[model samples]
Target: MAIHRSDSGRAPDTRELAKLARSARQGDTEAFLELIESLKGALYRTARTILRNDEDCADALQDTIVGAYQAIRSLREPAHVQTWLYRILINACNTILQKRQRQSLPGTLPEPAADSPVYQDVELREAIDRLEEPLRLVVVLVYLEDMRIADAAAILGISEGAAKMRLKRSKAQLRSWLAPADMGRERSS
Candidate 1:
């Protein structure tokens, strides 16, 4: 279901979202489903960015949904439902990563998801894949997801200043990786 965007086209009304959350907390299944439906795109992007594979992304999303439903009553701020959902998603992704780390060979990474919708550009995808977790997550939240630094920081449980620093560092790293090709193009031209 398409969320109803306001005239500004920013996000769905926070008041509406908060109402859904409050209803969901009170055992309204339809409201809970609606809330999840609205956030499905973002949840997928977040999981795909962190896990880098469809299977793990699916797992993380499932875990997040279940966890969020079970703990909906614990949510302190109804208006911050998006942030709360993202926090649960991030934790689910991290848990999957930790498990994968334990099972994988030393120094090896998980295979990239085939035909990933988000990272269609091969070069950019590889560069983002090479970034460390913190920087990579910041890039995903701030750049790919187009979230504010403060919002990204809240999801990542970091200070706003730290989120800004990570965004800067991620940009510099991406530029370093992508600049060589640009330089080659310029030289050829």
Candidate 2:
């Protein structure tokens, strides 16, 4: 026999998630575990967008899980749990990125902008990797994750207007980078 969960290619029910959040906040381990399972795939993608390394993604995820478990009780609004968890994951990913920057010697070569395993468009991913963290993050959350603007902003801990502005900036950058004439100039200069 096979069991299908709401995670089987369907959006989870908000009410069900709210109830789970409430239970998790009340110190129910199983509920929190369930919540994590349902959200892990999206969370991992978000981490990948920032860190670009599987090992770093793993570390960020581990940190996020621990951090969330410890702080669940303080999540005041159960309905906002998904974005809350996302925020924690983003913070963890950023922490790992900062540590990597500090550990690397100044003369060491930067890692290549890898072709994203998750997206078929190699050039797009490369362009995205070239973008600053704020713009790249908004693109990944809003476009790659298929998340709404407001929710993406919430997860980024920014106002919705700021998220929109970053998204616009990213689009302009991608357009400029991908243009044929711009590419020639970029290669030459």
Candidate 3:
């Protein structure tokens, strides 16, 4: 299914994306380039949310684009391009994370640069980074990427209800973490 955003104007039209996907699947290189161009920002933002490092984000995006282009012909529905593309991206990011885990000796890698625009609010970014992968992914996909829960579920390979539940739990967790102790005591009194 084509992902419909609440703020439709921010994203390219679903019909146009599908048409591009169809042509790309038929081995039209220009169409594939256009499709990837249109989704590049969203793809980068999603990757940034997961990886937090610009270098890793770029690597993941490159890998995802190459992987998607190779597998386009196998995609059963053009309308599902966004979902399929994100699924590939998430997998690519995970692959990078796995490699990083194996290669790094705990403190070898530098901390995420605070100056990055994507991490404007350090506290919020740290809180998000602290979330478990599944919950963090749901939050990033639905909230950060402006994706519908159904679409997020499609990418995550989860039921819509499960995606919704994850989002709910993430919000609660974020709130508790962000909330002031004084605020909680005030509310109780």
Q: Please list the C-alpha lDDT of all candidates, in the order they appear.
A: 0.85, 0.84, 0.85
Using lDDT, give the best candidate's number: 1
Clashing pairs in 2: none
Tens digits of per-residue lDDT for model 2, 23-120: 99999998988888877877888888788788898999999999999999999999988889899998999899889998999898766655655577
Q: After superposition, how far is residue 54 of candidate 2 from its true place, in Å?
A: 1.1
Q: Residue by residue across 1-189, what tens digits does model 3's lDDT show?
A: 233323542666778899999999999988988888888878888887778788999999999999998999998999989888999999999999999888889668655634444456888888988888799889978877778899999999999999999999999999999888698689788
lDDT of 1 by residue, 78-107 (tens): 989999999999999999989998889887
Better of 1 and 3 by TM-score: 1
lDDT: the better of candidates 1 and 3:
1
Every model's TM-score:
0.85, 0.84, 0.84
Lowest lDDT sum, 10 consecutive residues, model 1, at: 1-10
By summed lDDT, the worst window of 10 consecutive residues in model 2 runs over 1-10
Q: Of the candidates shown, which would achieve the greatest TM-score relative to the real structure?
A: 1
In model 3, state the lDDT of residue 48: 78
Better-scoring candidate (TM-score), 2 or 3: 3
TM-score of 2: 0.84
Candidate 1 lands at a TM-score of 0.85
